[model samples]
Structure formats: structure tokens, C-alpha cells
Target: MSAGEPGTGVRARPRLTVVSGPSGVGKSTVVAELRRMDPTVFFSVSMTTRNQRPGEIDGAHYHFVDRARFDELAGRGEFLEWAEYAGNCYGTPRQPVLDALASGKPAILEIELQGARQVRVAMPEAQLVMLVPPSWETLVGRLTGRGTEDPEVVRHRLAVAEKELDAQGEFDALVVNTDVKQAAAELLTLMTGTAVRKPWSSS
Candidate 1:
């Protein structure tokens, strides 16, 4: 297939799906729930230059690499999508996603909005789902409740979340994340069309 939207001759549902939202939008929570609820799908693990957080396992949460290694991989065209966030670079390895899809399994990529845009240009046939918070107030609470970052960092994230929310229309679908399980179910259904949805609907 070409690196664009499929022609009229194509009928199969896209095997690749990109999930993106602003920081502190419960993306990690939803993804973890999705894994527990559906083992058949593939969730692409991203590589990042940021130091691993407490309780995070390398290769499970993210493949932690230094700046030089990350730059070398990016230069080699190994990343299908990549971007810098909070001064750290994150990228999705190209081959694993392709291999998963080639094996007839749906692949879910959790990335930033910038990387999602790159995926749209590179794989237009793939579905782009924008996950959002129930309301602006809830989003602020979530971002601040983490208490991991400084006040300045929290403000920056809230600003970025506002911009990401404005671009919701660019997505193929919108998923309001009121609860983790429901959001994951919605994402799973969007990818494979056969998930047992919980009690939640898109707004």
C-alpha cells in the first residue's frame, strides 16, 4: 500500500490506530486498561530520552535512551513517528508496528498530537482517535493532582492541553475519558470493532 489514504478499491478496516491527547489526559491509564481487557491487540512501546520514573520498567513503560542514541535512531529512519515534549524526544519504532499489523493483529499507538499528525501523513488509512477529558475543570484537576511536576510545568501542560483540545476535529473519532475502563473499551472498539463497551458515550 502507498503512504497515503487507500484508494476506492480497499475495503478492509485499518489495522493501525493512533491515539493522542494532551498531557495528563489519562492516556497511560486507558492504555493499561485496554491491555488487560484485550490481549489480542498490540500496543506499541515508544522510545524516549527521558529518565524512567519510579516503578517504571524499561521496555515496558518506555525504552529509555540517551540523546545520542535517540538521535542516531531518528537519523537512520527507524522511527515512523517522533517528537520532542518537555525537552525529551519520544518515538515509535517502525518495524514492530508493521510486524504486528502484518501478523493480522490491530496495532495501537499512543503518541503525542505532533506524532499523530505525522502518522496521518504517512498512513492516512490509519484511524486517529483523540482522547479528551470530560471537562476543562476535570483536566486541570488531573494535571495538578499528579503533583510530580513543578507549578511552572503544570501551567505549561495545561496550556498545551488547551491547544490539543482545539484540534479535536482533526481526529477521526473523539473519546471522552470519564472512566479508564470505558475509554479503553471505546478505543478497543474503534480499532477492532468487537469490544464490550462500558457505560459511557462520546460527547
Candidate 2:
């Protein structure tokens, strides 16, 4: 079929979507679930200076780098947005996201609130969506998981989370995460305008 023909279904021009939330709000889980449901979605992987953990693959989980290398890249302005977290630096490489969008694949950036602000400045057209937990009690429970965290540490985390949650109004969209699969499907639908098959019928 010729381009833009009446019978040919034209694909929507994919856009860049920035997904952010509090530290323990299950943003990673939802993004992973979205990936499982649709491999075509372009989830932007970040580069970090933190040491890779046991199960992390270098290029997959994150592009692990030394502090000096990270600094060099930042100085050259290769990152769309970058920030320091827990004494380590993490940044989204700008080109890959542009490449994915130019080729018509929705690109998702699973980042922190700080980085999301930076992205807003760098790419004003990108969509910003915040993932919020079902409730404060649930977030507290998730933050205190295993009960191994120091009371002081947990308190600090909750304090930060409160501030992050307050910034929901700044976002273009909000996804409440009661179930990982449901939230993921909703996010995918928002990004693509196409509903996906639910993993299970009853839920």
C-alpha cells in the first residue's frame, strides 16, 4: 500500500515518556512488566557509576562506568539528564532515546524525580508520568520490607517520598500502582494507544 493510503493503517509517531516516582514505589517492577508485555517498547537504560550487583548485566541493567568516565560524558553533555543518588551518579544517554523515537518506538525513561525535572528542561515535549503506590500505608510497608532497614533510614526515605508524592501535580499523568500487571498494562496503553491482553482475566 502507498504511504498514507486510506487502507494502510498509519502508526502513530512514537514519543518519549518519562516515568518517575518515589524510591520504593515499584517503578522498576511496572517497567519490567511492560517490557514483558511488549518488547517493541523502548525503555531507556541508564548509565551509572555504582558497582553492579550479583545478577546485573553490564549493558542490560545499567551501563556501568567509573566516576571519571561518567564525569567526562556529563561534561560533554551527552546525557539528556543526570543526577547523583546515594553518592553515585546516574544519567540517561540522549541519543538512544532520540533514535528510538525517530524510528517510531515509544521510549520510556524510568528515572527519579530529580532526573525527570532535568528531562523536562532538556526535552520539553516528552510526556511525564508519575507512578504512585496505592496508599501511604502500602508505601510504608514496601519501604520497610524485611524490617532490616534502620529506623532512621526508613524515616528519611518516607520523608523524601512525601515530597516526591506532592509533586504529582507537576506530571502530565499519574498511574496508581495497586497491581504491577495492571499498572503496567495501563502505562503501555497510555504510551501506545493500544490495549494489551491482560495476563489473567480475573483480578
Best by TM-score: 2
Give the Cα lDDT of each candidate. 0.85, 0.88
How badly does each model clash, as a count of residue pairs? 0, 0
**Model 2 deviation from native, Cα RMSD in Å:** 7.1
TM-scores, one per candidate: 0.82, 0.87
For residues 142-178, could you state the per-residue lDDT of candidate 2 as single tens digits? Answer: 9998588899999999999999999998788899999
Q: Residue 161 in model 2: shift from native, Å?
A: 0.5
Root-mean-square deviation of candidate 1: 6.8
Off by over 4 Å in 1: 1-14, 52-54, 147-149, 194-203
Q: Clashing residue pairs in candidate 2, if any? A: none
- Per-residue alpha-carbon lDDT of model 1 for 94-189, expressed as tens digits? 999889988888899988889999989877667889999999999999889888899998998899899999999888889999989899998887
**Cα misplacement distance, residue 69 of candidate 2 (Å):** 1.5
* CA displacement after TM-score superposition, residue 43 of candidate 1 (Å): 1.0
